[model samples]
Target: MSQTETNRRLITELQSRGLRLLDESAGAPSRRGGAGPSDHKAVQINGQTVMVPVHSRSAAVSPFEAGASGANGAVQLTRDGAHVGDIRFPEAPRFYGLQTLDGVPYWKIAQLHGTDVLATTVLQTCVRYGRRDTSCQFCAIGESLAAGRTINRKLPEHLAEVARAAVRMDGVRHMVMTTGTPNFTDRGAALLCESAFAVRAAVDIPIQAQCEPPDDPVWFDRLKAAGVDSLGMHLEAVTPEVRARIMPGKAEADVEQYMAAFADAVAVFGRGQVSTYILAGLGDSASAILETSERLIALGVYPFVVPFVPVGGTPLAEHPPPDAAFMRSILQPLGRMLAEAGLRARDIKAGCGRCGACSSLSTYED
Candidate 1:
């Protein structure tokens, strides 16, 4: 195929498999994506949900074919967006080179997100992860735990050790530390703060931390004071029914708790710094997700919408991802709302939004 033909085929193939460019412009919310209420192609390949172009039917091709990327589609060409060259992976920085005298792999502890940001989940196991009624259906938090890939929790000092190495050794510019829920009064937020403060003392990299909204909104201020520059309070689903079904334990907090937490986070982290994830295809409608997003934007919080990609071996294992067209439909209206609020994903200082990986919301915003 000609290079242009090869590129077009590559885009079609990737879209057929639910992948798209991460940065916005051509396949934007209002453009060719499903956000328009127009029919977009969908298929089940090997039982996984995929969003195909309306005219094509196939699985994904290698990302190397076009200027597209593997993680987020940052370089996919769309008609309206800026024609920036493809965004490429940041090289493994020097910090990934060093290890403590103990010989624990530094990259294994925490790794860079996207190009330059360091991200780690210090505590990777959730209390009710495997239990039938307590786990978040969408989370694979304990998948690595089951395979002995990570410890249930890492000590503040251990986390600090890796954080320092990542900064001084790697060209890492920002940091994000997250944890599974701990059965403590601090709800694991306190431990994240301790680690953040330690990393701050060692390097000048800004940090972002995520956790379940603590029992008290006051903890948001505590995290900010402890050198955490941004916050991610994830509400994976929008409606209460979906939340309860997908994340029974998290749903226990109630929507009111989440709203209150968002208000508190905005107060401490400022507008555009606070973020929440709202997964698509989880039994909620496009209107429902966008309506919630609109309300969130009004309160200076970002609705980081993502397509529900069913990770292997979770309770939702048998479940399928939402078709890509549905994700496009939801993102279009919501992206507009976010744009009007001036809540560009890049404006998020740290975490998933800034990395622009894990979801296509950033592309929609484009």
Candidate 2:
């Protein structure tokens, strides 16, 4: 295989099967139980930072394992006991040590994703998360909060303070502010707008705000006016049956609602700035995912398809992530479709799709 193809396959395999570290200290702190990057760790392979499953059940028995770290901090990786190559873990962000004036730790308010992308959950509490029947089976959004690792609600001022420090001390390039769905008609858009406005005022970093589609389309303009450069309204599953079965509460929004919202968001954020996350391992088939990606691309929305690695405490904790073959079937074609549509992750200003760390689809775009 060519070098590019090798990297693509390697990344896909690592994400699907996960990587087990012989010594936990060799890897950076693995994020466990949170709104984003849950049960995973950021690993830099071939100079590309990707989030791989390191705490999932699959990882415990994964064929790939990281051995001892070299003098230069590079760790040797072995697949099924045979050495594959060396990989490095990102140093913990320097801003993590700072605290707000009110005595809250900065790390609890916002966390770093990938190498330089700073991310935070504006509102950790969600209306649907309180009930098992209404919750997304794959979600562990409440885990971090219950463990006292994060505050239920992050004040806008605290967010601004932490964001500024992250940019100044760690050289963070962009910020992603996502919120749990709130009960109001505006959903979490209102909170996101308030939070994004504060962060933008404190620092000039680009921001991506994520929330469920609001009841009214006018909120798109409101979000743009608040200095949000990108928007993400995720559609975790494409097929209605799968959505309803997997996430009964979120499925209530329906595909039609998401489609309309995507159009409105694209108009405000521009073509490539509007994006949605589509987890591939859920019940949706590869064909179903590709169909959704095609329609999303036509609507000027970037569909970020990533493997669904189960979180430790979620209902689907034991559920197996999509195998490498299954993921490649969806991502390879989806990457071509994105390139043909003139949509690329590198062009995105800020967001999960732009970070492209949780998925290898970005590699296939070439």
Candidate 3:
């Protein structure tokens, strides 16, 4: 196979099958405190950073696992004991050890994501998380907070302090500040604007802020004026049936509302700068995903298609991730659609889709 094809297949397999760490690699940094699966470990394979599940069910008997023996700090990746490739683990960031003047660890404020981006949940608590019917079934947003790995709410100044330190100590390229929905007319836009403003004053890094569509479209302009370079209003699942089933409370916002918000957001943030995340395995058909992608691209919103990974503690913990073939079916054409529309992730100013490590769509972009 060609190099691009090889990479695309390898990434899909790794994400689908997960991987097992050997005894020699016991000390590799593993994700413990954050949203989504806390069981993931970031590994660099084929010169790309990909987060793989190492502590989930799929990992226990994954066909691909790191070999016990290797030399020169390189580990051999094998599928059923046959050599597949080589992979390396990324070390923990230098900023993790540092603390603010008040003694809170810098990592608690923001953690390194992909290779060079810093990401954090500005408000760790979600209003819907209190009730089972209203919560996003796959969300683990509060798990990190309950474990004391993150603070419940990050003060704007603390976020600014952490952003400055991350850039200076580890060369963080950009920052992603996402929040659980707070009870306000602005729907968390107010806090994100305040936080982004503080960070911009402290550092020169680009920032992407994510939240639901606010009650008023004018919040988009306010967000732009606050130094947010990009905006993300994640749809997660496109079809109303899947959306209601997966994220009941969130789905109440309705796709029409999201579309309206995307239009206004694109006006403020520009075409490729506004994006939405669409999880491919959430019961949305491939055709459904492509249909939504076409509409989103038409509105100047980049559709970030990612494979669904089940977080361990959520209601859907036993739910399986989308098969690799299923993901390929959506991403391949979606990549072409994005290319045709001139909406490549590289054009995005900052955020998860730009990081593109958790998903392999970027590898397929032409």
- List the global CA lDDT of all models: 0.64, 0.93, 0.86
Query: Considering TM-score, which of the candidate structures 2 and 3 is the better prediction for this target?
Result: 2
lDDT of 3 by residue, 187-218 (tens): 89999999999999999999999999999999
Candidate 3 — which pairs collide? none
Q: Please, what's the RMSD in Å of model 3? A: 1.6
Which scores higher on lDDT, 1 or 3? Answer: 3
Measured against the true structure, the TM-scores of the candidates, in listed sequence, are 0.76, 0.99, 0.96
- Residue-level error in angstroms, candidate 2, position 58: 0.4
Give the winner by TM-score.
Answer: 2
lDDT (10s digit) by residue, model 1, range 1-366 = 575433333332344243333432222121121111111222222222223323212112212222344465344333234342342323345776677677766665776554466767877766777586888876777655566544566666667788777666666677778888876466788888888887777667778898888878788888998988888888888898999898888888887788888988898899989888787778998988888888888889888776565555566644655665676677667767777778997777777677654455555564
Give the TM-score comparing model 3 with the true structure, all chains together.
0.96
Residue 348, candidate 2: alpha-carbon lDDT: 97
Model 2 residue 20 distance off true place after TM-score fit, in angstroms: 0.6
